[model samples]
Target: MPRADRFLSIRRDPLSDEVLARGGDPEAHSLLQRTGFVPVARAHETYHRVPTNLAERDEARLATEAVGRLRSAGYHVDCEGDFDTDHRPVHYLPLGASVAHIAERIREATTTDEVADALTDLTAAHDGVLAAVDEVLVALADFHEGLGDTADPHIARRLRYLAEERLGVITSDLSHTRNALADRHAPHPGRSTCTEQVPSNERERSAVCACPPPPRTLPAPPPPPVAAAMRR
Candidate 1:
């Protein structure tokens, strides 16, 4: 069975231009640089604490806005959380189907032919996800370019950086998947005495000698915090 590669977790933040320009809030600006900026409604209470109910509603609205932003940017919205202990809502948007699902298909394959087919399917799935990420980068670039001189330089820089980072991850994942498949399909140096030599093609190889082992499950990482708001 083929193990799943670790998925990238993206944190989104919604920040206002005013907050970015504020003198004492480097944290907000730093978050914007790291996660890219989304538009969020202004908080009414600058000094005083906001009421609990109002805070929760605001967070919920932010999460919904984030989901929409991601979709518009060309990502598949898997699911989202309501609110955390900090009263912040974080959304989980996977690029495609879970790696676990692909792993399950690999594990269930009982013959060499089946395993080979599963590997092909997994490779194709990975390619599709990489393509989706590329589409998102193109869309973001188009949007940024459309803004021309009116675009905020800081926001434009952060968006470009985020897009590059995503492309790097997707490209790396594709390389890793390709290497793993190659290792799996490579011919062994020595022949086993107990069994006849299997065919060169992976599909025709002997099941006992060529079938992949059960994939090891990696522990899922902690959810990323909500960095900012996505404005509607």
Candidate 2:
């Protein structure tokens, strides 16, 4: 038989065969069964070919696994079938970091400097999410334009609604957080600590008393709104 044919002909041994091979060792047989191990042909067959349909299915399974990982790491992804020339679906994931944790950190901040640092970090994270949103939107718009009437009219409409309604609300919340922080840190005029008085030891002599200004207390910033839907 040709090498490929021989490979294709090779099959796994039956469970009964496995049990008979380990006849005296019931524990070992049980172990094998428990592990679901299937005995395969020992002959090396390098030309074995998998059916194209099976290969495509495995590719799709792997892509789905990859997208799951990306989402776990805080990304926004959209995947659909027939995205590539080879008919393999492509993922349209965007790069964005979660800001929910940042909000919690800001809430836990004890000092003004800590709060300021948290605000800065939150700003950066928000910007990153916004940039990712913009990229996805632009890409979708271009795709829609390219397809014109050939594209499903509802597809673009739904995407636009998500981008505007969902993402817009997130951006607005971020702006509110920024404004609250800015207001908390804004400086205000206060009474001075310097005073002048006549010296008791020398009636004609005048002395200036310079007292250190009391520490200014900053009002606590309003809690940042939680973005449960925008976890990624």
Candidate 3:
């Protein structure tokens, strides 16, 4: 990741007189948001602002907390004097991180069963990640049903379609893949399991493993350097 992504500033916008958080990547943005800032997306850039109508003191408090949280997460935040502090707040790993862990497991998997085990976390019938997401979407749709806004019904319908149609497709596909892999009982041909054993003919008496080094994942050789059009 870029070093710039770990730096941000929290200050009041002169024109709007609103406390705004500028710079930082998506994770940093999420941290600011959870600290009570609303996101403002524009054609050129995106930033976060303390909710409007809040008292000036409340806005400063929110900004201070955001600075502490960002610092705790290893981010550099430049803020106004009132918002700067040495206190770093404690934050727990978010629920999304657990789902991301499944992807990490799949990346390191070398056998069909290993991949299947990770997929089970997402596709399990009883309380898997996708199932919990479906439940949340349904609940949100229900909440919007009686929200009394002119657009509430439409919003609810859209949420239902996403929960049922879009998410359903992913759940179905991953479930099928998981089931097939569960039955395959095969290891990846291109990868090998490390036996952690020294060969009998080993020249090094301290050798702990005899497995060949894993191949480096080189990027596709830059698009065969595009040749310039021959002189006409």
Candidate 2 structure quality by residue, lDDT tens digits, 27-89: 222222322323332355221121233454554444444334433433333444421123222
lDDT of 3 by residue, 1-232 (tens): 6498899999998998999999999999999889999999999999999998999899999999999999999999999999999998898888789999999998889999999999999999889999999999999999999999999999999999999999999999999999999999999977667789888999997976888766899887756677789998
- The residue-by-residue lDDT of candidate 1 on 132-175, one tens digit each, is 55667667766776575765555666666766786667666755
Give candidate 2 regions above 4 Å deviation: 1-104, 111-128, 147-151, 186-232
lDDT of 2: 0.45
Note the Cα lDDT for every prediction shown: 0.44, 0.45, 0.93
TM-score of each: 0.30, 0.34, 0.81
Clashing pairs in 1: 1-212, 1-213, 13-227, 13-228, 13-229, 14-228, 14-229, 39-231
Show model 1 residue runs off by greater than 4 Å: 1-95, 98-100, 106-127, 147-153, 186-232
Runs of candidate 3 exceeding 4 Å displacement: 196-232
Maximum-TM-score candidate: 3
